[model samples]
Target: MTRRLLLSYLGLALLVLAGLEIPLGWIYARGETARFSQSVERDASMLAEVTEENIEEGKTAELPAVIGEYAAESGGRVIVVDRKGIVLADSGAGSAAGPATRPGTDLSREPDIAAALRNQTTVTTRTCTEGGEVLSATLPGSSGTTVRGALRLTYPMTTVTDRVHRVWLALALAGACVLAAVALVAFTLARWITRPLRTLERATTQLAAGHLANPPDATTGPPELRSLATSFTRTATRLQHLLKAQHAFAAEASHQLKTPLTALRLRLENFEPYLDPRAHASLDETIEEVERLGRMVQGLLALARLENTATTPEPVDLDAVVAERVAMWEPLAAEQYVALAVTGVPAGQVWAIPGALEQIIDNLLANALRVSPPGSTLTLARAPGTELHVIDQGPGMSPADRERAFDRFWRASDSHHDGTGLGLPIVRHLTHASGGEITLHAAPGGGLTARVRLRPAGPPPRRLARRPHTAAPSHGSTSATVPGERAGG
Candidate 1:
């Protein structure tokens, strides 16, 4: 997490640097170039005016000397060309008195001179084969309507290029230094964000391992992580309290229900033979009610154990698990004259507690069998990724009933038999403990379908020992009576 946060911060810093530096460098380059151009333009115009005024005053002899002085002071070159393209005077080169006269010299071949001849100003860059570099500017010199001459000036670009290079190097160095500094700051900030998250993670691991007393320090890290720590601490406290209360209730209730169940079983045993046929039928109903209560108490105890369980999960083949349960429950379904079916077993397995998994499946199947009609079908199947589903062709539960189905002691009023009502609740608790969940919906043939999704098992610690199928006993002793077979009775 700290590495991730640091990467994120550095990425943002690079973005900000790119956004700032590129455009700023371009703007600085343009501003410096423009200012240099303006200075050259001003000096070129001044030189041109000086030559023009001297020529009009009939002081042509002094023009070369005056232009040469200005060129030397400005660190540039100056040349005078007449309207007939004659190179009359030169500043850097010696007096043009030798090869100075020019006519048809084709001065128009030079871009800046041509522009100046056309009464427009021009600037250009050219490299000197000599140990120097220069930028040239040309401006027209006019007396009244007639063009008298062209004034050309050359400014050295070496100084400007050197300055630009220095500025760029400085900026690059500064950018590197800034990036290094920002990286350090980003690492610090990232550590600040991630340290508390690491603590929270360790706390979560401990909580999962059943060490629920200790909580993370909420005052550490950033605001969001700190808030999360506070929330986890509060949640752990509440959960611990609730679990203690539930365990106490389950233990107390189990103790209380034991006496009633024992007394009810004794009474039913005593009344089994003494009463007439009608009285015997009522006694059977009472005995069934008492057994249902006993089952509910057992379910409560199972749920209580789940609440306090600290056992780590292990790998189990869910297909074989569901298959075994189906086989065990088949006789019971047959006795009720319900068609029991199985489908969709995958070769995969799941990580779960074995007992919890079995109890969950049993409760789902038992509930479905209780509500379904005699000829109705019960389907047990495995879905994708180690999920088991138990479905029945019975009256589908309403939305409200489905929502409340997992609450302890929940029972539909339409149920025909006496039920413990804690079956679904225990199923839910055990499912959660095994890192899975169960959902119920209407089956295709107008019945309840309970779908269980589970986590796939990892590799096992050792090989499983093979056992005989009969070793896994069926739930009931009597053979199933088909629905039609009992119609004549």
Candidate 2:
């Protein structure tokens, strides 16, 4: 933008200079040429008057001497011609006496000389056979109203052209100096205009990066830019306040609800022993619903905490985290008669917030297990490109459900699990917050697949110990399998 502004200013300056300098230069050259022609005509008229006097006195012998002296002084050639179109006195070599005694070429046919013989003074410009151009002025020599001869003076045009060229050269130099100064001023003005915009750009970048604690200064530059900067600072302050209020509300609501939920759970536990055997099933169902609500509240609190705190991602062992989560959830899978398996590449590392990976794995595993049929396998796999996939052999969702899967409190109409619907939304938020992506798709064979792609953090530290791939056995049963060592299933 700065470069564009500078070019625009320089272009305008050049246009102005061209408009002003071109016509003035042409006029100067024309005036100089006209002045030179006038001077030559005046000299020719004076010489013609002197020759007329000599012709009336019949002292034509002194004509050559007079003409030669004038020619030498004025740097021009002179000639005297009678009405008969014959040169009588010539300012040429061997004319030491007078050309009247040894006449030269006829001048009656020459245009300017012919006009002069008719008593009319004429000045004209024409090329010379010898070389350069010449300006010729002819004046009639009259002896008391009778034209006797003509005086023709010729001056080289080179002197006039040289003078015009010098004037043009000086103008060119002056124009260049003015243009240089204009360019310098234009550049300074452009920088002045863009400096504030550059500062605003840097401030905008910082704001986008969540560094709104220090707003940009609004006191510099023109009034428009200053006003814009002030507006941005105010808007950023208002946004900061709004976010703080939202986070405060979420944290307060979650904390406030926890006490009553705990009290209710305690009351339900106390009343469970007094219920009859037939009613015990209903009590257990109520307890489960209460537990689900408690988990939903906890998820909300965790999400609120994540939103309020800006946590930078760090290196984490994807395989190690997955293996640990699988072991923890293995007992529940076994109780449901679902085979829990670990598969895909081993020892992969990714960058994620400290506890985000664990929460995501736990939620996905819980969701998968809840829908898996007995004897069906639930695979916890690490795919290429720093991705993790939880595949379950259960009923999958339609495309419409997958599209809104990340929306908070959204659930499929035919969903079999009793979930609060916050699990997937939390997973999505955490994934994005860590600069990753989460997606749901239908597994290859059957059921749903939850895929999480994360940013890789290179290899794990060498000091970190590798854990053996094994799931905790439930009730002494060993139905789960760790396939080929390379396949890791």
Candidate 3:
């Protein structure tokens, strides 16, 4: 983290240095050059006027001395060029004697000379190999109608370039100093920004781990971070309240179920004397009812625990779980002469709470078998995505019965076997908790099919995409193979 922060600081510093220094250096260099060129142009124009005046007065002998003195003081070269481009006088080197080397050359071809001949002063700085190292400008003057000439002046640019370079160096150093200062400030501020965030992370982890003894300190960092700490404190307070309530409920529920179960067990012991068939049937009925009540109480306690416990999810194998449950219940189905059939039990996994998938299948099959007639088949099939269907050819319910099947303690008819009516309710709750669903549908062959869709524990098998189906016979139907196909009562 520190390395990243330092790198970020250096990046910002370089950007600031470039932004402040590069353009400033370029402008300084251009301005200094422009000023030096303009100065040379002004001096050249003044010299042109002085030369024309001296020549017209026929004081040509004084011209060279005057021009030379001006040129020396100005630190530049001055030359008078005649109409034919002949160097008539050289201020820095005295008069040009005999035929000048550039005699009879066309002055019109030169940009400054062309402008001067048009009676306008032209100022420009140019590099020339022959004219020595100088910045030069030109202006035209006329001593008479026959003597038109140009006054050209040149000043060396080395001094100006040196000053510009010095200014550039100063700017770059100042920019570097400023960048260093900015980087220090930014580093300190970034640390301040992330410090509160780190504290908040630790606090949140503690909260998730059930550390409820002390709340996070509210007085830390900026206003936003302090506000976040306050929110965590409030949320922790609420969780503590909820947990207390859940504990109380579990304790109370456990105590309440104990009395009924003890009384029922004692009552059963008193009914052992009857050896007649009627007395045996009565004992069986009472025992079944008591057992159903016990199961209901157990389910209620389990559901309460499931509600209160913090459920950390893990992968579960739906198909294997379903098959295991079916194998366990196979003996019961066989004793009743009811055919138990299972299909599409793939060797795959799903994501659910452990034991939830088994419980769901058990409830579904139990309900189907209770209503089914003897010799009928109980079918179970698993589809893609951890989908399980327990279809039974039992006495199917109307639409109203289907809707209220999951309601707690609901019963469609009491003429059938005694049940706690909590089976479907528990099934629904467990399914929801496991992030799955349960739906009741009419089977294709006219029985009830309980479809259980669970979250896949692993990726689906990459094979044939055929849809799986399982069919079973109806319970209490006319074509029953078993003799005692009595409706469960």
Candidate 4:
């Protein structure tokens, strides 16, 4: 923008200079030529009067000495023609002349000389071998309207042309100076206009990174940019406050809800011993429901925390995480008569929010394990790129259910399990925060395949060593995932 502004200023200045300088130069050149011609005419008129007096006094042969002094002083050639159209004298008379026509030469046929004999005074320029470019002024040598002879004077055009050249050179130098001044002023103006915008740009990048570290100054730049900076600062401040409030609510609400649900479960368990045999089942069911509600509350808070925080992605080894998770869930799968297996080529490092990959894998594995039938295979697979696939030999969701699965608390209509339906949404939030996406496709066999796409973390970091690592939602499940794929606040 600054460059463009400078160019525009230079372009306008050039146009102005061309408009003024071109005409001024041309007029100056023409005026110089006219002035030179007039000066030549004045000199020629005085000499013509002298020629008339000499011819009347029969002293024509002495014309050379009389005109020689004037010709030497003025740096020009002179010619005196008789009434019969013959040359009486030439300026180059008795010396080694430089290409000038000598004495007794006929200059009567020359255009200016012929016009002079016709009693006319005239000035014209012509090119000639002897004089290069010639400016000639001629007038009649007349006494009482009877022409005695004619006098013609010629000067080289370089005398006037050199002055015109100097004037054009001066104009060129002046124009250059003006353009330089415009460039300096334009540069200053452009920088002034764009300084605030650059500051605003940096401020916006900081805001996107979860907080605005340094706000832009609204006191500089144009009024429009200043107003924009002020508005952006205000908006970023409000958003920060809103995020802080949300985190506070998530923490407070999780604590507030967990205590009462635990007390209620204890009260229901107490009632179990006093109640009859038939009431035992009812008390147990009530206790289980209360526990499920508690898990739902936890899932909700986890999601709230995920939404409220800004997490930058870091490199995590996908293969290592998958192997570890499968090992941890293997015992659980075995007890349920299902096989927990890891397959597919090793995907190297991938970028994910620090704790997010572990949480996502936990939720998906927990969900897949719950839905897998007895003796079915549950696979934690890593594709060649930055994808993790959890294939479960469970009842897969329909197309419509899959599309809406990521919605908060959205369970399939035919879902019979006790899930609160927050698992998939949480997984999606974690994936997006890590700069990736999640999609559900039908499993290759007769199950569901949850395909988790992630950003490649490039090469693994040089400083880290292999590290060992480490929860979930509803159905009273200790882990984050529940049977009905439920989640909470």
Candidate 5:
């Protein structure tokens, strides 16, 4: 950005200098040349008058002396030619002004001299062999319309060229100074504009990290950016306070809500033995209701904690987690007389929040196991992409139910009444938080298939410890059911 801005400034400055200085320089050059030509022409006319009478009278002895003095003072060559096309006086060998030339030479052959003999004056610049360029002026010395002689003056054009060169050099120096000044000013302006933008960017990053210690410097830069910074700061302050209150509420409610419910469950259970034998069924049903309510609270609290925290994703071995979870759930499958197995090609590492993959797989397997018929099979499968499939040979849901499966407390019409409906919502929250996606579809052979798609991760470092291939028996039996399979698959 700074480079672009500086280049724009320099470009505009260069154009302005070219527009103003080029024409001025050209005009000065032409004017200086014109003045130089006029000077020589004026002098030629005066010299013509001086030698006109002498040449006509055919007494030219004093002519050479006059030409010599004038050429020495003016650094030019002077020639006096008579109307008969003969040179009467020449500033050649006697004067250090021009090449050696003898008197009585025909001068009318020269273009300027021929013109002058016709009673015309000519002024022009031309190339010369001895000198680079010379300005020559020829004026006729006529009396009463009769041409007596001509005076021809030749001066070097270097005098005019040198002045024009100096003017161009001066313009070049001025242009360079202007460009330098523009560069400095442009650099300052660029930095000024971008500094506040950088500040806002850093502030946004820190805000997303949930640790914005210092907000943007809204005191500097353009008014628009300053206003943006100020508004962001105000909003961030309010959001931080709201999140703090929510965290505190979840923490406090976790303790307050769990204790009383736990006490109530124990109270209800203790009365079971004292009740009449016929009332036992009612007591058991009440106890079950209390337990279900407790599970709902736990699921809700889990969601609250998830929402309040931000965790970065890390690489997890996809195949290893699937294997471990399958083994862990195999015992329950055996008890229910349902087969649990892993199928499909091996999936490699995938990115997920820490501890999230384990929870996601456990919940999905639990729900699958709950719905499977006694002779049915529960499969944890993988395919070409970075997606996992939990397919069960159980009754499948309609498309409408599948769409609303992620909604809190939503359940299929045929599902068990005991379902708390929080499971699928919890699963969704975890999946989205890890930057992955979850969807439900009908399996090929008529069963519900829950598919999770996640980002692939780079291979783990060789120096890292290897994960065990199988699930350890020490894992809690709670791994068997995804929130009692009440969790949505």
Candidate 6:
């Protein structure tokens, strides 16, 4: 933008200079030529009068010496021609003694001399055969009304041309100086105009990255730019306030409901022993419903806290996190007659919020266990680029279902599982907040693979000898200790 603006300014300067300098230069050249011609003609006329007097007094031989002297002083060539169109004397032949005729040097054939022979004074300019320009002036010599001869004066046109060239050179220099000044002014103005916009751009980027503590200043630049900055700052402030209110309401509501829900669950458990067999089954369902509601409230509160809190990243043990989560789910895997295994690097560190890795693994494992059939395998692996993958041999979702899988309260219709549907959405929000990514893809054979990429913080702590290892569920009917697994199971 600055370059374009400066170019436009220079273009206008060039246009204006061309408009003014061209005609003015031509006028100066014409005026100088006319003035020089007029002066030469006057000198020629005076010499003609002197020559006429000399002829009448019978001293025509002395005419050559006088004309030669005048020609030498004026830096010109002078020729004396009789009325018969023949050269009487030539100053350029050095002696100016007598009728000196050079081949092809007939004075009568020259335009200016021809005009003078007709009793008219003439001044003209022409290019010589030698490729230089000359100005010639001719005056008729009259002896008491009878034409005696013609006195012609010739001078090189370089004198007038050089003068005109010098004038144009000076104009060119002045125009260059003006253009330089204009370029400097234009550059300064462009900088002044864009500086504020650059500042605002940086501020806007920070805001989008969740850094809203400092807003752009509105007091710089022109009035329109200032107004734009002011509006942006106001909008950011309002958005910040509205988000704060929303988080506060979510946290407060979730925290307040926990006490009542816990008390109700305790009362229900105490009354369970007196309930009939049929009523017991209904009470168990009620208890499960209450637990599901409690988990939903807790999930909402967790999401709100994640939004409200700014968690600084730190190095977490990826291998350790996956191993621990799989261990906790091993009992449930055995009870379902499913195999749980882990592979890849056993000691890798990734940058993530504290406890976030554990929650992600817990939720993914829960979802896999609920859908995975007996004899199927659940594989947890750590790949390069700080990536983790959980592959389950279960019925996976279609492309369209996967696209909407991250939306809260969305579930597959063909699934036989009961879930609140907030698991994947919460995982997505948490992963994004920690500057990571999560994606779902079809497994190699059949089923789904959850791929997660987290930022690397640093190298893992050195441990003992390393070796490839895997964990599979033991043969038994059992249950596993689940962490944050209520929503998906």
Cα lDDT listed for each candidate: 0.69, 0.74, 0.66, 0.78, 0.78, 0.74
For residues 166-193, what per-residue lDDT tens digits would candidate 3 score against the true structure?
Answer: 9988997888788778778877877675
User: Candidates' TM-scores?
Assistant: 0.63, 0.72, 0.59, 0.75, 0.71, 0.74
Candidate 3 runs further than 4 Å off: 1-30, 39-80, 84-103, 109-111, 114-120, 124-136, 141-148, 151-219, 264-293, 307-320, 335-337, 349-354, 373-375, 394-442, 446-489
The per-residue C-alpha lDDT of model 5 at residue 325 equals 77
Backbone N/Cα/C clashes per model: 5, 2, 5, 12, 2, 0
Which order, best to worst by TM-score? Answer: 4, 6, 2, 5, 1, 3
Writing each residue's lDDT as its tens digit, candidate 4 over 79-129 gives 888876688877863222246666677777777778878888888888766
What tens-digit string does per-residue lDDT give for candidate 5 at 116-219? 99999899878776647888898999987999989888888877889999999999999999989988998898879777788888888887766578889899
Q: Largest TM-score belongs to which candidate?
A: 4
N/CA/C clash count, model 4:
12
Give residue 193's error in model 3 in angstroms.
Answer: 4.4
Q: After TM-score superposition, what is the CA distance of residue 156 in candidate 4 from its true location, in Å? A: 5.7
lDDT of 2 by residue, 17-96 (tens): 88888888899889988999999999988999998888778888898899989877767888888776688787753222
RMSD of candidate 6 to the true fold? Answer: 7.4
Worst 10 residues of 2 by lDDT: 480-489
Tens digits of per-residue lDDT for model 6, 1-489: 778889999999999998999889999999999999988888888888988787668786897799779877877777877775567666773222223455235778867778778888877777655567788788899855588888877778887889999999999999999999999998998777766676778778767755576677677777888888889888888887887888899889988998899899999998988988779988988888788677677666666666666645567888887877777778878988989999887547787666677777777877787778899999987887888898988878788788777777676776555566677776776667556899999999988888998878765322111111112323211111122222232
Give the residue spans of candidate 5 off by over 4 A: 1-23, 39-118, 122-173, 222-228, 270-289, 393-404, 407-417, 428-442, 445-449, 459-489
Model 1: residue 431 alpha-carbon error in angstroms: 3.7
